[model samples]
Target: MNTDVDQDDCWICYRCHKKLELKQVSVLYLGGRFEVELMQCPQCKMVIINEDLALGKMLEVEKGLEDK
Candidate 1:
């Protein structure tokens, strides 16, 4: 999937009003952990997962794990 949002674009944090930084984050799902690049707030450490990652790579991983 293609995203119109630029990868370098600055994102704002809704909770702390701080700039969101792109960082490598670990996601846990169904007893599995995976790492993906995501936007996160520095102060709150809140990670934002986009639709493409959630529905694409993560979904594929989930299905693979379930099938095992």
Candidate 2:
């Protein structure tokens, strides 16, 4: 889990405008797929990727794929 994200805090869904729930989801990036826990809307199934995960693990994975 990314330390930057506050798991206790509740997030609102942008699409459905409902409360978001923390869930493990699979995301595709730069032809690679990985699973990460993120905020998601149960209604619309929209996933939210915070800055920490984007700049941290996801970026690292993307770079690794690109290098290969």
Candidate 3:
């Protein structure tokens, strides 16, 4: 849930071409609110959800909520 954006990462925003920074983002899912640090664009406010998060913890939490 927490990660640092290293200078070597060099992740550029597709839309703004600005560098991605590590920021705290609020995620609301299944009536639950969670705060996670992720790579985000400062100009456009776009958040990048990586593959590990999308198919890993996030997916697991989503499935668990749907089954309840």
- What is the C-alpha local distance difference test score of each model? 0.77, 0.79, 0.82
TM-scores of all predicted structures: 0.81, 0.81, 0.81
TM-score computed on alpha carbons, candidate 1:
0.81
* Global lDDT of model 1: 0.77
> In model 3, what is the error at residue 28, expressed in angstroms?
2.4
Tell me the lDDT of model 2 at 24: 80
Error of 3 at 61 (Å): 1.0
- Model 2 lDDT tens row, 1-68: 53355777888887789988878878888877777777789999898777778788887887887888
lDDT, residue 28, candidate 1: 86
Q: How far is candidate 1 from the true structure (C-alpha RMSD, Å)?
A: 3.0
TM-score of 2: 0.81
Could you say which candidate leads in lDDT? Answer: 3
Q: For model 2, what is the error of residue 56's alpha carbon versus the real structure, in angstroms, after optimal superposition? A: 0.9
Q: What is the Å distance of residue 34 in model 3 from its true position?
A: 1.4
